[model samples]
Target: MSAPDLLDYSRRWPLRLVLASVGLFLYLPLLVLVAMSFNDSRQTTVWRGFTLDWYARLGGNLELLAALGNSLAIAALATLLSLLLGTLAAIALWRFRFPGLGLVSAAFALPIVVPEICMGVAMLIFFARILPWPAGLPWPLSLGPIVIAHVAFIFPFVAVIVRARLESFNRETEEAARDLGAGPWRALLDVVVPHLKPSLVAGALLAFTLSLDDFVITFFTAGPDTVTFPVKVYSMVRFGVTPEVNAVSTVLLVLTVALTALALRVQALAGEKLAP
Candidate 1:
């Protein structure tokens, strides 16, 4: 190899080492957690033997089951709501040039930029003070309130992803569809929707995962009866971390990995269709 090629290869090795080190730093703890989940002992310090006791324990734990159900319901609803609103907003923003468009977009994204803890506290106060049911009327402030807060935070992420996808869309194809006697709505539903599918799927997955894993925001907004998985995990950790908690973490990590792989496959298919 030439001297310059040798020099470039030498520079690349350190960068690769740095990248690998970063990945290891981020993932080693998760690996330990997963390994400890199978440890026979309750203590996290030493591994006595490998067993599935923690997984079995998870199945019999009613509290954890209830909390897991609550978290799933909340995440599903929040993901749906965020996807609907965010997709509509992204489409509107991309297809039109309205006054204060940039400002409106930024406003929509404020939830993502703000600290989640702050957003949670602020939303809690808003629900308590600014919005209240009238006397002799019903008020929804438990799970509903928590779901709304999660949707608020999750929508920004969905919008950002969908907007990026929409920006790269081939407008000429849409225009041609319109010219070929397709109405605007039909063009959007048939052509644009298909093109935006990958982003929408990715965004929904991201929103669902974030909503499911969030503890701080859920802690502030969730009522006593509406405990989520992360909140349950936090409560358990407060007393003491246990192998069962590790089991739950391992399950979540596995689920996250699976979802990410599915998203990647969807995106790859989308890219193939987009390639000229």
Candidate 2:
């Protein structure tokens, strides 16, 4: 509208252009993948007429469905186990000081910092060669050792999240509960749990997402009999890419995003409760 304003706008155009370029570079491929999932033609490079056949066909693919089922089952189990162990670990580290407590706390977090490949290999060895289980142990449960490995890694995330949330919580309520003749466990269950519930939920969703998306660790530890969705997708791509792959992947992507958003929302609610 004016000479000075126009000059300033022109000066800012380079930065805006750079940002737009970066955004497209990051997301353009994902936009293409989502679009192609509806393509009638199997060829990825060529755009064909739109159809929902790919999504419909996913229901009929038994092998892919089985892999998806395995992924969900492992993720669910991992979320529960991690929440239990990690919550206790967080509360313990927060409520008490003891000899080697720093070391112990660091030990809880070590898995997060370690390379995933290293963790996966270590889990594979620990399950197959080390930890002695019953001779009658079933395959995958005791063989693939996926859920165990998932818990080992994901629990650290839970511990860290819960511990951070604990910092904002005042312990006065727990003390009041104890003052009212409640036992230690009673106070924990009645008082502490309610306050910590939101963080726990956020941690559970995050753990589930991590377990669902994990590939390197699952790939290293899974037995021949246990194929999770991601590993199955990898195998499928090696053979050939199909519209079904795109459809399944789009579904996974949407699920992951939804879970992550819900986790963040729960976390925000927890934070709002802490605000004055």
Candidate 2 C-alpha error for residue 118, in Å: 0.7
Find the 10 residues in a row with the least total lDDT in model 1: 132-141
- lDDT string for model 2 (46-83, tens) is 88788999999999999999899889889888999999
Q: Candidate 1's residue-wise lDDT over 1-276, tens digit each?
A: 888877775368788899889999999999988889888887656879889988999999999999998899898899999999899989998888989999998899898889978988887788778964233323233468888889888998998999998987999999999999999999999999998888888898888889988988888887667789988998999998778999988998998899888888887887798785
Residues forming the 10-long window of minimal summed lDDT in candidate 2: 135-144
TM-score of each candidate?
Answer: 0.87, 0.88
Model 2, which residues run further than 4 Å from truth?
A: 1-12, 132-144, 264-276
RMSD of each: 3.2, 3.8
lDDT on C-alpha atoms for all candidate structures: 0.86, 0.86
Cα distance off (Å), candidate 2, residue 180: 1.1
Query: Candidate 1, which segments miss by more than 4 Å at Cα?
Result: 2-21, 132-142
Provide the global lDDT of candidate 1 against the true structure: 0.86
Model 1, C-alpha of 146: deviation from truth (Å): 1.5
